[model samples]
Target: MPPRAIICPHCGKIIAGDESACSWCGTARSHPWWRLLKPTRDTARTDWVAPALLAANVVFFAVSLILNFVSHSGSILTPGNNVLLLLGASGTIPIDRYGRIWSLVSANYLHGGVLHLLFNMLALRQIGPWVVREFGASRMFVIYTVGGVFGYWVSYVAGVPLTVGASASLCGLIGALLYFGKNRGGNYGNAVYREVSGWVMSIFIFGIIVPGVNNWGHGGGLVGGIAMGMLLGYNEKRKETPVHRALALACGVITVAVLLRALYGVFPG
Candidate 1:
C-alpha cells in the first residue's frame, strides 16, 4: 500500500503519516486515522447579549409563575386564558380610573399566556443577536428596554389599555436591525435590511389579522428602534469596550434583582 500523508487537524499542515505532533499548533497526533478525515466544524462564537436577554425573559416568566401561585393575584395571565389580554380586555394598565400610572415599565415584561411568551422569545432569538452584533450589547439593551417602555407608553396614550408583552421590544430590535442594515449599506447590510423589512411587514400584517395584537406598540417600537440605531452606531464602528460590558452586566443584574423582588413580594417568608 502507498504511504499516506498525515495532516495536523487543527492547522491543516502536512506531516508524515507516522508523525505524532503537529508542527504548527503543537497538537499531538493522538488519532492519526481520524485526522485523515475532514476537519470538524469550528465552535460557535458566544454572544453575551442574546443569552443574557433570553435568561432575563425566562427568569421573569418563572417569577411570574411563582407570583401567580403564591399571591393568587390573578394578575399573571397565561395563554390558556384565551387572548383576554390581547383583546385589551385585561392585563396590567399603567393608568387606572383613579389616575394611577405605574404599569408603563412593568407591563413590558408581563405576558398574557404561554403562547405570548413563546412568540416573543422566538422573535428575540431571531433578532436579538443581530442587534447585539451590529449595535453592541450595551446599546442593544438600551434599545430593548427604552424602546419597549416607549412603545407601551405610546399604546397607553393611544387608549390601548391593559397591554403587556415583549413583542414591542422585539419589534424594536427588528426596527434597529432594519436601520443598521439600511444605514450601513454594504452588500450584507442591504441584504439584512431588506430581510428585516420583510419581517417587519409580515409582523404588521399578522397584527392586523390577529384580534388582539397591539399595532400601536409595534409601530412605536419600530420608530424607537430606528431612532436609537441612528443615535448609536453599529458594532463595527463602536467597539464593545469595558464600559459597555460593565453596563450590560449592570442591566442584567438589575433585571435579576427586579424579578427577585417581584417574587419576594408574591411569596414573602
Candidate 2:
C-alpha cells in the first residue's frame, strides 16, 4: 500500500504514515485506536455529510411514496398514516402496538408530505454546514441522530400517536448552533446565536400556526441538541477525538441497520 499523510493532532501538521510521531509537535502519529477511525467512510469528510443525509432522506421518501401508490391510495404529496407507519413513522402507535422502538431512528428519515420533506431538507442544507464547521462532522451526526431519538421519545411520552419528519433532527442542529453561539460568546459566536435564534422563533411560531406540527419533537430535539453539544464539545472548545469518531461510526451502522429493517418490514416475503 502507498504511504498516507495524516494531520498531526497537536500541531495541525501533516505526518507521513511511515513516521512514528509528529516531528513538529512530537505527538505520536497513532493512538491506541486511531487506525480504527482512520477510514470511517465519508463521515470523516465534513463536506459530504450534509449531501449524504439529503440523499438518504430523499431515498426513504421515494420509497414511502411508492409504497403509498402501490396500495392504490394516498395523497401524492401527503402519504397515508398506514404507509408512514409501515415505513417506520414513530409514535405511540408504532411503539406501543408494534413495539418497534427502532422507529425512533428510522422516523428521522421518513416524511409525511411533500412540504414536510422539502422544508426539512432545505433547513438541513442551511444548518448542516455550520454545525459541521463548528462541531465537526462526527459530532454533527451524533447530535442529529441522538437528538432525533430523544425528540421522538419525548413525543411518544406526550401521547403523539403518529408523526414523521426531519424537523426533529434539524431542531437538533438548530439547538447545537444555538449552544455554540450562546456559549462561545464572541463576534462569530454572537452572529451564529442571532441567526439561530431567528430559526428557533420561526420554528416555534410555525409550529403554533401549523396543525399537525410536532412541537414536542422540535422542543425535545432542541433540548437534546443543546445537551449533546455540551457533552460532545464543538471544534472551538475541543478537537474531534477517537471517541467522537467511534460514536459517529456506531450511529451510522445502527441507522443503516434500522433503515434496512424498516424496508424489510414493508416487504417480508
Candidate 3:
C-alpha cells in the first residue's frame, strides 16, 4: 500500500513525510521573516527556463562577437551591422522593406556589446528565476518571448532603424513581477511591488542618461508583461494549466521558425 501523503496547507498540494516545504507555494515548515526576502533555493532549483534563456543569449552573443571580430578589426565591443542583421536585429528597414518581422522574436537573443550582454544577463539571472517560480517555466517563456516581440514591434513602429538586446524581455519579466506584487496584496506582495517599482524608476533614469536607448521597447515590453500576467495569472492564484503549456509550445515553434529565416537570410544557399 502507498504511504499516507501529507497535504500542504499553503497550496493544498500533497507531499511526502520528509518534505519541508510546499513545492507549489514555497512555504517552509518553519516560517522566517527573511525567508520571504528571496525565493528559496528549492524553488530556484526547480526552474529551467531562466537558465536556458540565459544560455541562449550567451551563445548568440558569442556568435555575434566572433562575426563582429571578423569584420571589425578584431573588436568584440560591438558587432557589425551585417552580422546583427544576419542574426536578426529589429528595425524599420528589416521589418518593413524586407518583411523580416521574425526579428521581433530573434532580436531578443542578440546583444550589441560585451557590456550589453553582461548587464542584461545579470538582470535576467536576478529576476528570471523568480518569474519562473511564480508563473511556471512555460508561462515565463510566453511572457519573455511574447513580451519581447511586442516590445520590438513598438520600436519598429517608432522607426528605430536598428536595435538589439535582451532588455525588452528582461523588462517584461520585471513587469510581470510588478503585476505579481500589486495583485498579491500583503507584506510580501507589497515588498515585491516596492522593489520592482524602484527597478522601473532606475530603468527610466538609465534610458534618459544613455544615448540610443529604446524607451519604446522598454515601455511596450513592460505593458506586454503586465497584460500577460493578468491573462495567465500567477501560480498562487491559478495553477499551471494546459493553456499555458500550449502557449509555451507555440512560442518555441515560432522562435525556431524565425531563427531559420534569419539563417536563410545569412546563407541564401
Candidate 4:
C-alpha cells in the first residue's frame, strides 16, 4: 500500500506522508488523530455572531430564573412578570411609563418561560446561520437588532403592555431568507422561498392559536427584515460592503448601550 501525501494546513504545501514536519514551512505536522478532530478551514472561519446571540439569550433566561427563585422559591423554571420586567421586558409600560425604551433590545434576550425560550432558541439556531451565511455576520447583526427594535416599536405603538423573546429577530431572519429566495431566482432559490414561506405560515398559525402571542411584533420584524435585506443585499447578489459593517457596528453599540442603561435602572446604587 502507498502512503497518501499529506497537505500542510498552515502553508498549504504538499508533504511526504511519513515526514514528521513540513520542511518547506518549518512547521510540525499534526497527528492523524488530531487531524481527524480538527475542523476544516471553512468551518473554523465561520462567524460567531449566531452563537453569541444564542448564548446571550440563555444567560438572560438563567438570570431571570435565578431572580425569580430568590423572590419566590416555587417560581423555578417560569419567571413572573415582575422579574421579567426587572430584567427588561418590552411593552408600553416599559417604553412609556418608565421611559425604559432600551427594553426593546433587552427584551429580545428575555423569554416568558422555558418553553418560550426553547422555541425561540431553536428557531434562531435554525434560521440565524442562514442569514449570517447569506448576508455576512455584520449584516446579520444589523438585521437582528434593527428588525427586533422595529418590531417592538410597532408593538409599543399598538399598545401591547408586555412582550418578550427572540421570535421577532428569528422572524427577521426568515424575512431575509424570503428576500434571498425571491431575488436569487432559480431552483435553489425557489426551494428557499418555499421553505421560508412555510415558516412564515407556521408562525402566523401558531400566533393565532397561542393566547399571548405578539403577532404585531412578528409582522413588523418580517417587514423590517425584508426592507433591510433589499437595502443591504446578500452575498450572492452583492459582496458585503463597508456600509453594512458600519451599520452593524452602530446597531451593536446602541444595543449594548441601551442594555447597560436598562441594567443600571434595574439595579441602581
TM-score of each: 0.70, 0.83, 0.87, 0.82
Runs with alpha carbons beyond 4 Å of true place in candidate 3: 1-37
Residue range 55-79, candidate 2, lDDT tens digits = 9999999998898889865887778
Tell me how many residue pairs clash in candidate 1: 4
All-Cα superposition RMSD per candidate: 9.1, 9.4, 4.9, 8.0
Model 3 lDDT on a 0 to 1 scale: 0.84
Winner on lDDT (3 vs 4):
3
Q: How accurate locally is residue 51 in candidate 1, as Cα lDDT from 0 to 100?
A: 72
Per-structure clash totals for the candidates: 4, 0, 0, 0
Candidate 4 C-alpha lDDT tens digits along 61-93: 888888888889336789899888888999998
- Models ranked on TM-score: 3, 2, 4, 1
Better of 2 and 4 by TM-score: 2
lDDT of 2: 0.85
Model 4 ranges with Cα > 4 A deviation = 1-44
Clashes in predicted model 3? 0
Give the lDDT ranking, best first.
2, 3, 4, 1
Q: Score each candidate by Cα lDDT.
A: 0.65, 0.85, 0.84, 0.80
Per-residue lDDT of 69-161 in model 3, one digit per residue for the tens?
A: 776733557787778988899989778777888899999999888899999999998888888877888999999998898899888888899
Which candidate model has the greater TM-score, 1 or 4?
4
What TM-score, to 2 decimals, does candidate 2 have? 0.83
Q: What TM-score does prediction 1 earn?
A: 0.70
